[model samples]
Target: MDRITLKEQLEKYRTPYEEESAFIQDFIQLTEDPLAFNRERLAGHFTASSWIVNPDRTHTLLTLHKKLGRWLQLGGHADGNENLMEVALKEAEEESGLKNLRLVENSIFDLDKHIIPERPHVPEHFHYDVRFMIEADLTDKLVISNESVSLAWFTFDSVVDMIGYNPSILRMLEKTSKSEILL
Candidate 1:
């Protein structure tokens, strides 16, 4: 979709947490810029992510990010794609080497704007991330990709401890409760 059309039609969802709600507003504002959907916009750009869980929702898959050296959900730059849902699915499939993914809900599951540390030729910038919930089999084989140092699955409680109790990641864990997952 074209930038202007997308800017005028971005979907807004309810997030109880103040931080997430604020991020949604900022995400909407980001769309005002013509380059917001493209990775080439160095200032910042949209990224889509998937909070991948097992089919039974008993575990979550995380990748040890190569650059940040932290376990993170699967995702990548939108690359000018205005359909974030599709982008999230594509990133999940590429990063985890998992197939036959299913969306738990076809809506925004979480919103995050994190700083991307500076690299050789890329300066630090915010990633206005839109996340979605995805499901796959726990028994499926996973192939690590170039973007990660490692990849693995863990229970929700295990993830809570593994990430060193990070607030945002904690928020996602809290949001993905059993009741919500069952829906």
Candidate 2:
């Protein structure tokens, strides 16, 4: 996706929570910049994440992020990939080593705007994260990528109890738990 297409997608996205309206609008404005998808944009940049759940939605796959030292959904910098859905799929595959995972939906499952702490050479910045729901078999073999300290499948209740400490993660989990959840 190019700038126009990315902007269009952001414009079409609707968040159920009224408080998140600001994040949606900010993402739209960020897409106007030529460097919106580039990691080099220190102010902020686009990223894609996969909320990987089992076919029955009983469990989710989470990686103990090496950089953050916290269990997080699989995702990564967009680099120059304007198509976030492609980026989400690629990241999920690369990070989880899960093949033939199904995209539960083609549209956005969640949107989060958060700050990325500064690393040695990288300055702190915000990530206009676009999340997509994905499904994988529980019996599938998973290879832990170097990007994570470890990976595991957790029950939805456990995820809510563990990661729900973070408001953003809590929001996503709450959305997934609902039977009528939409993109």
Candidate 3:
């Protein structure tokens, strides 16, 4: 999908009220076009993730990515699937091991693109991340998956104070706090 195609799709389905569709639309756009990432090499490598807000609304869960070692929300690459939301949900379940998760289908946020530093075989990279907000019951014990070094619940305020979270996480926390998605 070229920029024109992506922009047309964005304009077509992207609304302040629609969530999943808009995210997937943008994800498709970024994956199709390289310029959307603002960096030349990041054309096709796109991903999606979810910020699983707890029932209490006071805290949000974050995973310390084992490879990146940064406190971040649960998400990963799309692997060329058309079902981007499923990708986000799957990542959340895999990373957090929480079965009772619920995605707020209408509470999607903007797509964020960030650089993933070059590595041995992967060349310099960036991820055009489509992010969503989900409300899950704080109803079960969370088992951090191998992909994460540690898992912890941080209050919205604490999440803001956290040293390594990307700016989009803060935006997600702010957006979720204002929505009725929290149980």
Task: Evaluate model 3: give its lDDT.
Answer: 0.68
Candidate 3 lDDT over residue span 1-183, tens digit each: 334443454565453434334345545555455344342345346577888887667888889888877898888876655355677889999888888888766433556656777767666676867667777776578998989889988878788677455666766766777765654
TM per prediction: 0.91, 0.93, 0.75
Relative to the unseen true structure, what is the C-alpha lDDT of residue 105 in candidate 3, on a scale of 0 to 100? Answer: 66
The collision pairs in model 1 are: none
Which ranges in model 2 have alpha carbons more than 4 Å from their true place? 180-183
**Residue-pair clashes per candidate:** 0, 0, 0
lDDT value, candidate 1, whole model: 0.84
Report residue 42 deviation for candidate 2 (angstroms): 0.9
lDDT of 2 by residue, 16-65 (tens): 78756678999999888888899999899999999999888788899999
- The model with the greatest TM-score is 2
Q: What is the C-alpha lDDT of each candidate?
A: 0.84, 0.87, 0.68
